[model samples]
Target: MTETPLAPPSARRSRSRGRSQSPRSNEPGQNLHLRVPYITRNIPTYDLLSEEALDRIEATAERILAEIGIEVRDDPEAVRLYREAGASVSDVSANAWRVKFEPGMVREILKTAPAEFTQCARNSANNVVIGGKASVFAPSYGSPFIMDIDGTRRYGTIADFENLVKLGQSSPWLHHSGGTICEPTDVPVNKRHLDMVYAHMRYSDRGFLGSITAPERAADSIEMCRILFGSGFVDNNCVIMGNFNTTSPLVLDGVTTQGIRTYAEAGQASIHLPFLLGGAVSPLTMAGSVAQCLAESMSSCALTQLVRPGAPTVLAGFLSSMSLRTGSPTFGTPEPALGSLVMGQLARRLQLPLRCAGNFSTSKMPDGQAMQQSMMSMMSAIQGGANYILHSAGFLDGLLSMSYEKFVMDTDMCGALHAYMKGMEVDEDALGFDALAQFGPGEHLFSTDHTLRHYETAYWDSALNDDQPWETWSEQGGIDAAQRANTRWKKILAEYEAPHMDEGIDEALKDYIARKKASMPDAWY
Candidate 1:
């Protein structure tokens, strides 16, 4: 990439640019910053996994599949495919089918899979390729409100799809445009998943997160990505799908697992997310809750590895506590914060990527509480060294809704946290011995030529935080973080521009969705 020229010292001095003048009375101090590593130390590292344990887990999973078999149901096409692959099947009912697994088949599937994947952004420089030393971030799962052009908020709709793609295009931090933005209610139910895939490809020049309604639909989604980026591109550390709901021992479903197998066979990385509600689904104690989550996630990971040995998979454990009184999932609770730290440690032990939730808010609007919770949670995940952090933005009330203000706040917070994780740089220029000499002790560095030369290199937090005094804050209407976030949201939306796409690619995506819709069975619109 070409580098931009730096501004001259004199020019920088005249600009009067530095940290925001707003008083940071509410800013957490140095002690708060120290908490990053403190929480990180609580979890165990990846080195804990013994070679023998990994082997045992893999072997045990294969035996479980071969001996016990997986229950497949409500999808005849999936049943037929498994049977054709040499699995035993029983037609339990007109709509249900069960498949008996063979250990060898699982191994065969794993061999062809890729170990890493990459999600290319519109700007190639910002691209996030997963499966190696680095980690990537995705927008939070399942948000309901979508930001519109008029600066108004409404329920997520097809239009929100366009806006989200545009936003993803603008954000270098977000690696992929995820599914489940706004349900394309106007589209047929079976075809809605396909429509989302098509929209992501055409509207944003980034890799996609796959989650179609069924196995066959997942195949179509993979194929679309393949056609856009080329065959095996989807397998090359680009595509990822969450195998959720199916991995829960208490609520194992057929359709989600079918999607997992389909993606696994296609060589895409399949991350098994075992979501447990601490007070409800599992034990209330943090350790016991985490252990339960570990068992569930590890079981799924073991199964995926057995189904496809050495297949690129992640251990995803989402343990949120449920509010016993309100019957709501409370993401802002302290238990989830602790759980993510532990889960990150477990992933490290397994020598696999760990996917955890972050930037989650329970408040209906972006507020002080929202900012505090989101930042704290995200810092925990990053400090714990999670490989892929999901649900990084636009979520609230435990993923049931999204707020535009909160999304923008998250963007700013993510930017700052990412800066924090970069730690300190130690180049000769950064040492600033010459600059130190230029501005001796007892002298102000602000007016020195050396300070002027390098001032822009310093990190500056965005508007979500202000460093003004109470007097200044009160004069400015005493606006809290949420009001400021809303202002930022409006500003970003005002400057929003659509990304450039390949000529005719948009038309082709629409045509493909139309053809798929036309081909679906009458029962499925």
Candidate 2:
């Protein structure tokens, strides 16, 4: 191949200025960039597998479902539905049955599901599209502990949960308020879901996930959404979602299947996720793990369609590596990232939206290790084409603890991703012919008309990064990124403002929570 020669600087300077430049009247501040409700990727998704390889994976998943079968424990209705839908069901125990499907049955059932749908928020303007090219970032869910800003690791409380919700609301990068940002150990296990759902409604107007611990809790979450949004709106449109995990090694417990039915029957959305740990619950190889994940997720997702056709469903895969010597779970590894990329391809083939990797880390602190691991996992999700990303921030201690500083730092990275996913624009102005014409060789183009026109929005500015000279940084107490993140989160919480809610709705939610709490005794596990 022959290389093209570059144009001479003198010739470039002779080119005409394509268009005149105009200065923006109100220039945005460094930190005051635009906030998007959700990201629509302009760049193409990274497909790691070819068509033949994807077919082989799908065929393997089919074979697994047909031969191994999944145990539907304690859910007779689910087993009955499977039997009626042409799947073979046999009694394994008093309340458990083994269900097996043919090669194409699950896929045929999943065809009833919509490829994409809208999840409305209390503020209609903040509503989000949950499929196709859209990508929504939500805070982490189900952390029982917290790494406090004071550098102490302790159990999370209701106060901590509420504070995390406030921080999510304040962040411009996050679109969804997220569900169960942390477990409130201070409250009763049965009643904490009520409080968590209420906090998301009160503090943020963005859409969020709901409780899925039990069928009743799932119903309660839907009822609360009915109160916030009108009953008619709640029934017709998806406003809330439930993230349900299937028991690994091809087992779908009754409670999980029941919860899936509850959300689907109510016309709500549900994410069918299988947490596959390599060399433990699943095979050591990535390809085998992918097949197993596909089989489990497809079975649960098909159940949603059995309950109600056209229900919104997302196929999710959470693949993790493990320490072979100690048998502990690992996160943010390369094997799982490759698995995520393949999952994206499978989801597209199934014509369902995908929810894949996120800012995952096993590090206990929000340090270099945490950030490095997070980038590896997070980039997989972004490039692999996940639509709704849970655990986008505040994940630490392998998801056992939520770190405030990590939350802020991750949000700052999410801000950068907003620009990264936008790709680049190529137009008459972007070519910079005008700038070259305005300036000659050996002269700076900083003061050119084109520079001023696009300067403010040209690049993404980091809120936690330090680019000052070493002496300046040292004079300022030599603060590091974690320390700076700590200060940023505290400042955000101090100035936090809750979104508006109607007086009647607020009272109704409060009354509902009180009644529910009084109905049950405290149970701490």
Candidate 3:
């Protein structure tokens, strides 16, 4: 993949509000080397459907939208926006407004969406170019529980949340700091966004996901970001992307639409995700489920365009299924795998960036089940041509829990996947036919310059996966992968140094959080 051109010099103006400029890690001349490598498209994508099949799915989705229609919940302004956009909206029931799209309206609104754009990082070096050939990976998100090496599983707190952000900052393979790494249950629901954004600002220089639990919370996120990146910069660039998940079986709730409105109006990025549980929330068949996903994702994305044309939006596919016997949600299944592949094709056709799940699992332990599930979801996402990958690590218990050990384990695997995606080089230097000719038959080239030159990066290495003899393993006490990962994570947190920031800016951010928390009433529900 080719590199995108840099933004113009005018886009790099310093913090210019009424106050003086503040110190930042990426303030103009400073350089930081913590930038990780984002995946680029280098191999062929997996095509599971024929052209005829894909066309059928698209037609089915349009038919679903134009006929049965989808509901927009408790948001008259959203209904009005759709009404004004030529959609037929009906409020025939309490808290429900059914919207029927005119034929081709979905595709028409999608025309204004960008095929590629940049999500700016505090440090310019860490900026991510989403869409096009870029494939960026973020850490696990929205898990409510935390797990440790002693088999401890419990509610997560603010301390646990900050530590996870630090871990993401330290990982060389993680691209984004993630959203809701683990919910800080100790904090009040209404005010947690302030603390969460503060943690991200203090511990991570990478770009981050925005709050979507409430529309007001989303506005607070933008306000805090304005303090960090300066008002002018935040307004003109996509610094934080919000994740807006629509309710399945054709419902768009008020909180979600408001969040979308807040971000879309500010020129920020938003991922229009629909969490589908096939055979339950949607159709059992992959094609039918994909068609539902298209209607849900495209319809919500079109709302963003209506709010503000040219707003950066992503088409997300988080379609999974449930076990027929127990009705328990399952991850890494074939249905979701096919859904991811088809999602990629559809996103490309609509000229928008795509987001897909990663390392998702139902396992409670970081064992074979966890690894298998993670590999299954991640492999399909990468090969399916996803532009942005969320939940790239630590997702467990069907995304209800986050495992520290599993996070480290998944990072190792993700790095390997990235290496594999960056297909082999075949230049004269890479071919090295001359070096092979020198070695001749049956002779060792271990002492040659070629071996020494490529030894550092010629092969992928595992941080925790063991491949030693029994005697060697015994000498190391035969500790399991989880134990090794636990030790590694502790070391990472201990050695992690937060990127530098201006003292004045840090104090101002603290003041803002304190005032914001005091302003809002404590809310639990």
Candidate 4:
């Protein structure tokens, strides 16, 4: 906690002194303090459920935990830990241990989890304070396939991963570098976490997610973070966030439990959630699915407090509706969107931060369907007071692929939405009373002092959203948004200059990764 503030992106500082200090930007007009894209909710949150409905859902979740019980699978250590934490652990199945909580266990333990905590970044200016009125938009995670700029769909490689990271770093609206932007299939499964962590640390100074595939990977992520941001800094501040997904149908798998335990015990933050595919993971009804998800997420969140009281946790909703006709999972559906709004209300009732799926689409390409579907989900998150929006961009085809164009488009959407979230300034200056009087009827405001002063920041401008006359548009070759994004990404990569990192620290990271890869045999997953 005593770590120095992070200097602005433009401020060059001595890392040996301390990495946490924040310094003003060297740019004449730019404010160094305004380093990353972040939003603070100034308007009331959109509550979808009535009080009666919310009360009923909470009661049902408690009942589900008490009577229906949840299966804690495959981890004896977790089973034992749950028993020690006062949940009734049973011996019905070796692999699946049935755990039923006593009436007040979940609610009581929930008291220890914090509502808000600071998620530190390498550049202190980019550090995010999650929860409360804040919302941080991060890129997509866990997509094995990537759609390249040339419109080719291929398995992701380390190069593809680095490209995504660099794009994420340069993005003005993406606040966090999401873990597993695209799964690097080219890298060995066991050691990819190291490369991914290195990418996050080297390419971007922003905050990012930690590993969750296995406890060892999670441990490696934590250690690597400690090396990047001093040991004193990592232990005292939350430098990484691990998304601990709950297995659907009310099961806490071993890997998830390990991820939660290791991250919590290390004083890092986590998004505790359940991935629900309606009809497959849970019931088709909204009420039924919400109850199951709340029970599963809250139970594991409470478990985090048991492992380390006051650990920062985000209540999450990743419930996707199933396409009844095809029986495949669907995103941006009415059901999941409605469920997310209700989930936000539920998390608010508990006074905790909420995380949910964002910028999602079932489309394979960045077309009309993709844009519309993604906007629906993102609007839901913004309206619902979601504090941490995961998979916020680049997601497509039911989370199977990360698209280069979608990433750019979604970030543009995020910038506009964030501007919307700021709400209009209703004060006298903003009213433009003088401008109205001086300009009179038919007068121009473009050259007016008020217009010139605020014009640069009054509205959000898109790097890829074209607003050109027909003649100019035709002269520019008439490319679509995807094509424009393709052009932009390539330019950004060519001009990419990474955030500063000390040579010794960078070498240390390389050494650490080299040792890690050498010690383990490549097990391609």
**Top lDDT model:** 2
Which ranges of candidate 4 are over 4 A from the true structure? 1-37
Quality of model 2 by C-alpha lDDT: 0.87
lDDT of 4 by residue, 115-221 (tens): 88888887766778788888898999999899956858989999989999888887667788889888999888899999998998888888899889999999999
Who wins the TM-score comparison? Answer: 2
**Poorest 10 consecutive residues of model 4 by lDDT?**
23-32
Worst 10 residues of 1 by lDDT: 31-40
Give the per-residue lDDT of model 1 (tens digit) for 1-525: 012113222222323534321112113331123221111122323333356744554555455556655555565555665576677877667766555557556445434334344444323433454543555666666555554223555566666666665555455445556666555445556777776776676555444577646778888877776655545434544444644554443333567767766776766666777677777776777666665565555544544554455556777777777778888877766677777776766655555667776887677556667767777677667766676777777776567666666766676666565556556768887787777688688876787676787665465445467689999999989987777776765655566654444445456666777798788663434
Candidate 2's error at 304, in angstroms?
A: 0.7
Clashes of each: 17, 0, 0, 8
Write candidate 2's Cα lDDT for 356-410 as tens digits: 9999999998999999999999999999999999999989889999999999999
Per-residue lDDT of 1-525 in model 3, one digit per residue for the tens?
124334322223322222221212211222222224566778878877888888999999999999988898888888999999999988768878999997798899889988988887666566788897888988899888999877789999999999998888777677888888999999999988889988987888777997999998899888888887788777778888999999998889898988999999988899999898888989988889999999999999998899999888999989898999999989988779878998888887787899986998999898889998888899888988999999998899899999999988988787677678877889987887766877788888786678777765677666667899988999989988888889978877777777766566678889998998888789886
Question: Positional deviation of 103 in candidate 4, in angstroms?
Answer: 3.1
lDDT of 2 at 360: 97
In candidate 4, the residue pairs with backbone N, CA or C atoms under 3 Å apart (3 or more residues apart, or in different chains) clash, namely: 4-20, 4-21, 5-20, 5-21, 5-22, 6-20, 6-21, 6-22
Cα-based lDDT at residue 317, candidate 2: 97
The CA lDDT of each predicted structure is 0.59, 0.87, 0.83, 0.83
Off by over 4 Å in 1: 1-116, 120-124, 145-154, 232-243, 306-310, 427-433, 469-478, 521-525
C-alpha positional error of residue 68 in candidate 1 after TM-score superposition, expressed in Å = 12
